[model samples]
Target: MIRIVITGITGRMGSTLLRLARDTADLRVVGATERPGSSAVGLDAGLAARLGALEVQVVDDLGRALDAAKADVVIDFTGAEVSVGHAKACAARGVAFVCGSTGFSPEGLAELAVCAKTVPIVAAPNMSVGVNLVIRVAAELARVLGPGFDVEVLEAHHRMKKDAPSGTALRLAEVLTASLGRTQEDLTFSRHGQIGARPAQEIGVQTLRGGDVVGEHTVYFFGEGERIELTHRATSRDQFGLGALRAARWVVGRPPGLYDMADVLGFQGNS
Candidate 1:
């Protein structure tokens, strides 16, 4: 059986992962962690996740958890800084890591890359299979449609989501820009009145947040006399949780490196 620890066990994604891991074959929840002061820190991870009891305590320190559980891998869904720290801790102990956290800055990502040189790490903004597939399909569409098509990306999430323009949205934009041979300078995050006509090379990204909507994203390709829309709507967080668990299973015993869902899913061109 694959022994695993989960970070942020009380959060939406964490709870789902805990439950899914319990039900999934060949996986065991050996440890779980939450923020140091959170009420969940001392509770049974299964109880905290409303899964009765699975004999795992929720701690605050991931390193201690990893050592105590003799964990094979750690699945983390905490903040960017927290996930980076977890990755380092896992690297120190030679435990693989699967992170589903978003909102990482350039420097934080660089830190993750550095940690990956020591142990395999799967870090992704959105771990849903459909979203990863959309990333690839969007790139292909951009390549086929060419620059004549005006591209715009729109994404929505719950109001509590901290990041504007969800990481998935930015990933889509990144692939789109790459496929079109453009750069970050060609992507527009916002616009104001009297901004003039949209530049031929500009790719627009917009954000929406309100209510309890799980997540939603749409990529539009507007061309003469026709337009194409590629959209993915997530009604629940289970997909992300399952995807992370899938990555955790695939990452163990692998060589040290940074990977994403595309690598786990075996997508050819884009990650």
Candidate 2:
């Protein structure tokens, strides 16, 4: 069995992950953690209404939680600030990390990459298998379509989500930019007012927020007299939680490095 610890135990994803872990045979919840001064600090993680009853408490002290728990992997669904500390602590303790936290700045990502030199870390903005596959397909489409198509990405998330464009949207944009041999800054076009005609080399991104949308992404490829559209919609958070566990299992004994769902799905490095 894979002994696992969860960061962000009181959050929506964390609670959902706890429930999913209960049903998996190869994994066990060894620890759960929230930030200091959190109201959930002393609650039973396994007693979440959706998870019924088990023997795990939501903790606050990162060091104490990991030191007292016999976990082989730590799954982080926390914010980037907290995740940075989690990464450092997990690396120092030689624990594998599966991070689903998003919205990290370039500098924060650089820090995580440096941390990965000491401990294996599997990180993805969106952990759904289908979403990862969409990235592969979108990259191929961008390569084949070249610059003829005016690419626009649309994403919708729940009102409670804090980020704009969604991380998955940004990843899709990254893949498209790479496929077209362009940097994100060179290709991304977000503007208003009397904007000139769309540039041949630019990709546009639009975002929407409403309701309880689990997640949704649509890629539009427009050409003369024709258009191709590719989309992926997530119906629940369980898929993300399950995919994270799958990644955690895959990174169990691997060497220290940065990895993503593409790696988990066995895609080419550049994909």
Candidate 3:
């Protein structure tokens, strides 16, 4: 069985991961961590996740937990501020990592990549299989449709979601921009006031947050006579939890490197 360490164990995604890992045939939850001072610390990770008790306690000290558990891999669904630290800690211990955290700045990502040079790391803004497939499809559609088509991204999430536009939406925009050879400067986050006619190469990204919507993203490629929309809506977090677990399974026993869902899913073109 794959012995696992789960970080951010009390959060929505993290809790879901805990339940899924318990149910998965080849996985075991050996350790879990939460941010320092969080009330969830000191609780049995499984019990807190409603899985009764597997004797895995959630601690705030990640390094100590990893060492104590003899964990094979760590799955992180924490926030950006702590995510890099967790990666670096895992790398220092020569433990593989699977991160599903979002809202990381470019520099944060670069830091994670540096950490990956020491330990296998699979990090993605979103870990749902459909989201990964949709991003790839978006790239392909943008490539085929050419620059004549205007690209726009729309994404919605629960009110508690920390990041606006959602990391997955930004990733889809990145794919669209890359496929069309448009750089970050060509992107427009909003069109308030008199933004004037949309620039010929502009890519628009919009956001919405309310209620308990799991997640939704729609990418539009608009041309003069026709338009194409590619969308994915996640009704629950189970798929993402499963995807992260799959990534955890794949990252173990591999050489040090950074990977994503595309790698886990066997999409060679993106990898």
Q: Judged by lDDT, which candidate is best?
A: 1
Model 1 misplaced stretches (Cα beyond 4 Å): none
Clashing pairs in 1: none
What is the TM-score of each predicted model, taking all chains together? Answer: 0.98, 0.96, 0.97
* Predicted structure 3: lDDT: 0.90
| lDDT at residue 261 of model 1 (Cα atoms) | 95
Where does candidate 2 have its weakest 10-residue lDDT segment?
A: 45-54
- Tens-digit per-residue lDDT, 208-242, candidate 1: 99999999999999999999999999999999998
What ranges in model 3 sit over 4 Å off? none
Q: How badly does each model clash, as a count of residue pairs?
A: 0, 0, 0
Of 1 and 3, the candidate ahead on TM-score is: 1
Winner by lDDT between candidate 2 and candidate 1: 1
Error of 1 at 216 (Å): 0.6
